[model samples]
Target: MPKLTKYQRRITWSTGIGFILERMDAMFMSLALASIIITLHISKAQGGLLPAITAIGSIFGGIGFGALADRYGRVKTLCWTIIIYAIGTAGMGLTNSFWMLCLFRIIIGVGNSGEYGIAITMLSEAFSKKYLGRLSAAAGVCGQVGSIVASLLSAFILPRFGWHVLFFIGIIPVVLAWFIRFHLPESKEFTENRDAIEKDPNRDFSHWTELFATPAECFLTIRIMIMFMIHIAGYNGLISWLPSIAQERMNISVAGSSLWMIATIIGMSLGIMCFGIVQDHLGSRLAYGIWLLAAAASVFLLIIAQNKLEFLIGGGIVGFCSDGMYSGYGTIVSKLYPTEIRATANNTIMSIAKSVGSFSTVLIGFLMDHFSLMAVILFLSGIYLVSFVIMLSIKELKHENKAPVTTTENAEKVAQ
Candidate 1:
């Protein structure tokens, strides 16, 4: 591989840092939720509603930010999101009332909504298509590192300093925004479309409408969206219950659960990197299908494992297969849309999928309360099968740049 140019290097650094910060903000809440509920004297039902509120805010925020990025610029939108999330995170520490905490979570969600979409689109546009999968996977890996960092901090800090301190630590990401402003350049694709943007400065970019206007586009978008929903639902649903499951099933401590989660995250990071390389070689469609099936089987294995070592191994494999395909989704979305509408299209589909997954957390938790772990795992595996079928239905969008005549000639030659 050739050495990265100054611009490409800057893109990688900014994206990796930005994604890490955003992911820390995203996963911190889940890791600290039990602590937060105990500290605030809230019930599990109320605690569950907080994430739902955040998801609701994210749905609207994603569409709004997507339009804003298309109209104004990606960097400006990202800067504002970082600032907003920082304030919300700090405020989450200060709020004593349940409703007030939920409100703050909504504020955080608004910032979190567009963070992934803009970063993925900007980085994808910055790098060459040949390197897009690797770079996208690298970002996913960075996000997992952030999750690991948050988990480590929660393990060390939450017991002594309390959950409030965790929110206070979120100030780091807010400060990182200034660095992003100085270091990250506007995407080349966005820059090239400046003239068109200038001509319609006030136009409303309804990404949902644009994406669903045609049958083929709608089919592809829905397939990706369903896959994302299943991935998030399965991964987050299991992880959210992991500590409780460990305590109930194996008589483990909170700290021990955190250690298990760390192991799972390590597997996630490795899987992200490996998936990128595999998708590039194997094609996204096939890579996604195989991984989804593996994830389903892993989830089932996780529920039945009686020994701690087997349980942890199953958890790691579940993490690897479930979260591994995330990078491919970004790469596929980038390839699916043209430059003009890429950010909006990517954000709209992904945000709704994320929202669905987030909302399902409560439902999953409720089911777990009533049913066995094995039953929940089986239900989640069924959802993964839905995603797998959807993924296989979509036509592969990679390698679209090759000449159509060349493909036709090759087909004719093969026939001879």
Candidate 2:
């Protein structure tokens, strides 16, 4: 009900821009893969490996830039990340050789990899605990917007202008870096920490050590890491398989398949919005449990749907239940750590989780080999169940001075 402060306003806008740009370029690779395989004269295997390479680049980028953001500065490092993302994206368009394409994709991966942890760290620090989840959802919703626009544009652009031109369009976010560099203020927490550092010139500020210096912090850190791993694994497994499942089961063409994706993304938007508001009201544990349980139930809905119309409707609900909980993590993760290493904590967990989650491809493949596709998908739902159980042990980290809290103290405070 209250107006967002100046800091919250800037972070939401800037991070939203970064997500839009970063995700659009990432989505472009998906749309361009077909044309790229043909133009580069590559094997089917190579086409599949392209995105994997980009992901690998992201792991390194996240660690490298995450630390830099802590050591150097958030705003300055963010501009650098944008520049790298833009250059990598544009270079992908200009390249003629297959290796060059791989190179540029890695570059793009490296650049975009740093976006989430750093930007979300900025957002988490800028706002109060009350608005953190909603703001986090808003940032992700911006990414969804970018993905939708990219989907639409790629449909229009690739057929008319070719895949290379699509990559050129990805570079448009480079302009955003200019605005961020000039207009965005450093996070207040980081700014004050910097001043403190200046006043005491010899103090050590190594985040990796501080993260484990205390048992409670270490326990919380590990718990969140495991939770992310399971959450992402289940999400990636189901969503990645949905296209093929829809195309085969519905017997639809590529364009028709887009309907399923669009439906799911719409669901994702609604789910994100719902989860944020609910979590802020209900506290993280209860909110996550309900959403994850709903996600599992929604997955079974996929099995019962007999037609495209039913499938589309189910897809929306599934998207909502499955990913809505994601809105909580930005607030939750940052809350567990201090400003001294907040970016470090977020990026570290994100990088590791994404890398581990990629194994969902292998998991699905392994499962389908042993069982039916429907059965495998249904089994994947149990992942959320497992995550929910783990979450029970992950208590909320409440601090004084109005820092974000991850758990509740009493039943009456459920909606506090």
Q: How high is each candidate's TM-score?
A: 0.91, 0.86
Best by TM-score: 1
Overall local distance difference test of candidate 2 = 0.72
Worst 10 residues of 1 by lDDT: 401-410
Q: Report the lDDT tens digits of candidate 1 across residue range 1-416.
A: 57888887777776777778766865677777777777788765566667767777788888888878877788888787877787788898887788888889888888788877877888878877767788899988988888888888878887778778888997886687547567466877787676655677553333556776656666767777888877767766766667667766887666677777888888888889999997777778667878888877778777678899988888788788878887777788777676767778777877888788876667776776677777778888899888888776776544533321112222345688
Task: Give model 1's clash tally.
Answer: 0
Per-candidate clashes come to 0, 2
| Candidate 1 stretches greater than 4 Å from native | 197-208, 396-416
Least well predicted 10-residue stretch by lDDT in candidate 2: 403-412
Q: For residues 1-416, what per-residue lDDT tens digits would candidate 2 score against the true structure?
A: 48877767777788888778765764566556656867888764566456556667777888778878887888888888787887888888788888888788788778887777888888877777677778888888887778677767776787788888888877666686557656577877888887776687555454554555557667777778777877767666655556556766888654455445777877888888888887777677777888878887888878889998898898888888887876577678876666767787888777666666655645664565567777766667887777778788876533322543322121124555
- Candidate whose lDDT is highest: 1
**Candidate 2 accuracy as TM-score:** 0.86
